[model samples]
Target: MNTDPKVLIVTSAFGDGHMKVAEAIENSFRRRGISRITTLDLFAVVHPALNELSRRFYLNNTGYTQEFYGLLYTMTSKMRPEQFMGRLIHSMGKRKVQRIINEIQPDIIIHTFPYLAAAELASTTGSRMPLFTVMTDYVVHGRWLHPQTTKYFIASEDMKTTLMSAGVAEEKLVVSGIPIREAFEQTQDREALLRKHGLSGDRQYLLLAAGAYGVLSDISSLIKRVLLQSSFDVIVLCGNNHKLRAATGELFQENPRVHILGYTEEMQELMCIASCLLTKAGGITLTEAMAQALPVIVYRPLPGQEAGNAEWLSGQHLIEIARNEEQLVEQLQRLEHTAYRDEREQHMKVFSRKSASDAIVTEALEAIKLRQPSVPAAKSMLVEGQAKTIHGYY
Candidate 1:
């Protein structure tokens, strides 16, 4: 630990979940009084054009563009290295990173996105700096693995096992659940939470979540069907999708039981008040709902990653998957008759007691403290002077 300790967090904007996880780690350090923290959107800062194109692809064509990503994934997985892709990315970013690292002289570095793995690999070429890769997703992709790296923080035991099967050393892996917003981990008064949202505590409150794009076309129609068939109150969160929000808003507005919100910061509170959740099976949202002990009813999930996530949730009994609106509603209606509530709670206990931020920060701090400069003089000064400074500040 160095006084005025420098910590760098590298992430990408490929998905909101990755950035959210990175920010949660940064927030944890900030809470511990580590103010000298820098967060880099490696894609934006290094390859702006590529980042924009990727963002546009996800927004405009992600639903149909899996083939393109699949090809890239295949290329990387083959050990081809695509030296050209690596060279191009590094050529654009190397000098800038060298300058930034030289100036900051960071004590520890944490990377949250896989593309940045190349950047970390390049940056630590000859340095002894500890680089911890945080796998924001549940599954381990070839993109995130690098042998020279110091360690990895993964989201689940399944992920850890996946890495082990891939031949990654067991000692280098730490099963830290995905770091989520601190607010999600804290307990909130459900009655007060419902009141704040202009919701009724007595009614069955359902939190409906879809990604920012609202990729699932059946979402609005499904919610409508539920409204007509069930007595529960539904709150729909159509993130950034104005068109979907407006359409859903029109349908739910006139009705007293249905509430449609575009986006808001009261997600934790909403989860607290929600008796159940109806949404796509994104890892963070699924885990957050589980953290709140809310049973989940997953609407139709898109193919690929989301489908995999839905499968994982179903296998854990943390959520019920529906092939269509009819089956989804049937599952929800059954919630009243079974111990489904306690079942979800019991299954979620494995992830509920774990703190993503705590595990990350603890490992990061240890790595920073254990680091010794190549020179004896700098090592002694870092141990005595920097350690005192870091303790005082953090």
Candidate 2:
């Protein structure tokens, strides 16, 4: 008999943060010798067509329609979990999710997306499978709260306080930072990594990433300003955005100092090599950068979650924000100063939780052990209960 716990990680690809968090958790479980693991994309599994369309719509809106996206975010930001919009969003995927639960019969279900699957699983009669939700952002949204959630692995203490103020049980919240891959926690030899990537160890490197979608507007202008104003070599990661890659290649073809890459798996190494990072404020990316102790410069984050993340990190003095070309250039110059860089690194060391993924896995395993019944005993109880029911009926 296999005693290994079966874990079902439900995530959605609305943005890369959700999938990244799921991957981190999966990797943590694998490292801990938990073999029976399955990962499901909730939207893709429940409603394929809707998932694709909604994903496209989200990217388009976040990339091009800033005002409209901000409007939608503002309109729903303060809604209660039981509100009409929340219920409607959750109900859309509930039936399909329940079907998945019935088929998998997992020991525990972990969610990285804000979906209604938790509520459905909780409402299932006689179901005791632990349901855990990992909030990828620093702020808590109403959509992420469900009374039925067995536990919440949140990003920070302030987030926990917010959830508590909104009536979440104290025991249900755990400040595990954000679940990032274990690689981020390991000490990276900067010189070795630079050599491995065929990059110059002598040159001061600046990394600019626009999330995984390359959605930041006027990236070309930003790159140009950085190159013209700073002495550092610029490395732009155009993740899965071929158009952005092609455009950047054409624009910086003559500049040997500018390196443009597309969809790299060496983000950790690149971040380690960077003197500073100028990127949008995606939660996972920020966490990864923080892990490396790299000074961060955030520019023109999108209106909702990105804005909130930027605000929180800046408030903590862990990052610098540049809203325009001049401020960006100035921030880059500031990063060149040894004292400023050291200050930011010290702040990051204080802010970052290096063992977040491991901590989350430990908590999850303990929670599962407390809730799980011995299989043989569970089967015997079921048989005895059925027999008594039949006898009573006769």
lDDT of 1 by residue, 20-49 (tens): 777788889988888988776755755578
TM-score of each: 0.85, 0.90
Best by lDDT: 2
Residue 222 C-alpha lDDT in model 1: 70
Off by over 4 Å in 1: 61-63, 66-92, 117-124, 210-217, 372-394
Evaluate model 1: give its TM-score. 0.85
Candidate 2: stretches off by over 4 Å: 61-64, 124-126, 210-217, 372-394
Clashing residue pairs in candidate 1 (N, C-alpha, C atoms within 3 angstroms): none
> How many steric clashes between backbone atoms does each model show?
0, 0
Whole-model lDDT values for every prediction: 0.69, 0.78
**Could you tell me how far off, in angstroms, the CA of residue 41 lies in candidate 1 after the best superposition?**
0.6
